[model samples]
Target: MNKILVLAAHRYPDKSRISKAAIEAFTGLADVTVHQLTHAYPDFQIDVEHEQNLLRNHDTVILLFPFWWYSSPAILKEWQDQVLTYGFAYGSDGKVLHGKKMMVMTSTGGSAQAYTPEGYNQYAVDALLLPFHAMANKTGMLWQPPALVQGMNDATDALIDNGVNYWLERLQELRGM
Candidate 1:
């Protein structure tokens, strides 16, 4: 079974609907660890070595966050900057993350229709996620299709439940259950 690590980042977790539901759904699952960044590092002082160790221990890595300004929250970016070092996440001798699988789960305030060339965002979500795909490629990790929960700002209970179910199912699949 793949040991999965979920790096959950939310600028305001308390105010979140979709992210909170997803995190709750992941609670107490076998071979799955949900690490909430804001709660763990409120001061934003990421432990690079510890983070790297966590990455090394997990067979699959899931990045869960709320889309902000068409990108992830600052802490996730900071975690990437600090933990994914040249000699660790990438470099001649950096093969620790090789063969691992990566999945990105995100929530967006806008509806699905808003993320298109003719919509308000004027770009597809997949296009906006290229950087993450590139990161996975450069780190030798297999990039899985991303899971997204759109229309977060007005998502109903049923929608939230559906998204949470999808995330839980994905995690279970990753664990080979």
Candidate 2:
């Protein structure tokens, strides 16, 4: 069985209703490990070796978090800076994540329609997530389309539940679980 790591990096966690719902649906199911970044590093101190080790063991890496300023939280960026080193995650000898799969599971406060060509945000979800896709490509990992839930700011419990279920089903399909 392929091991999956869900790297959850939510800064303002008290406001994360949608992201938590998605996590609750997947935790403790099959070969999965959920790592909460903020809780682990409240002081912004990350154990690079340990984080890299987690990636080394997992076959698929799912970055789960709310979209902050069209990207990931600070801790996630720190993780990428520290763990994805020159000789470990992306050098000539850095083949640790070569065959693994990488994808993002994110929630947004903006409506889905806003992330369109002529919309307010004026960009597709994929366009905003190009950095991640590029990172995956750089590291030789398979870059999967992101699982996005737009408009969580005004979402109801029923909406959150439905979105969570949809995301879970998509994850299972991605991992062939």
Candidate 3:
């Protein structure tokens, strides 16, 4: 079974709706660890060594966050900047993340239709997330297709429940990969 590590990054986890539900669903799963970045590092002081250790220990790394400005929240970016170092993630001797699988699971306020060329955002969610794909490639990790829950701003309880269920199902499926 693949040990999965979910880096759940939300700026305000207390006020969160979708992200909270997703995290709750991820809890208590075997071979899965859901690390809430905001809760762990409210001051944004990341422990690089510990983060790297977590990466090294897990077979699959899932980046869980709410989409902001067509990208991840500030803390997620900061975590990447601090933790994914040159000599650790990508360099001559930096292959700790090699062969690991990466998947982005994000919730967006915008609707699915709004994330297209003919829509308001004018770019597909996958296109906007190319940097993550490239980063996975650079680190030698297999990039899995992103799991997105869109139309979040007006989502109902039922919709959120369905999305959370789907997210849990995907995470459960990763153990077999």
lDDT of 2 at 38: 90
The deviation in Å at residue 128 for candidate 1 is 0.1
> Where in model 1 is the C-alpha error above 4 Å?
none
lDDT of 1 by residue, 139-175 (tens): 9999999988898889899999998898888887778
Better of 2 and 3 by lDDT: 3
| Backbone clashes, candidate 1 | 0
lDDT of 3 by residue, 10-49 (tens): 9899788888899888888888999999999999999998
- lDDT (Cα, tens digit) per residue for candidate 2, span 1-177: 778899999997656888777677788888889898898899989998889989988999999988878899999999889889887888899989998988898988888998999888899888999999999988999988899988887899988987898788777876684
Considering every candidate listed, which one attains the maximal lDDT?
3
TM-score of each: 0.97, 0.96, 0.98
Flag the better candidate by TM-score, 2 or 3.
3
* Candidate number that wins on TM-score, 1 or 2: 1
Clash counts for all predictions:
0, 0, 0
Each candidate's lDDT (Cα)? 0.90, 0.87, 0.92
TM-score of 3: 0.98
- Ten-residue stretch with the least lDDT total in model 1: 168-177
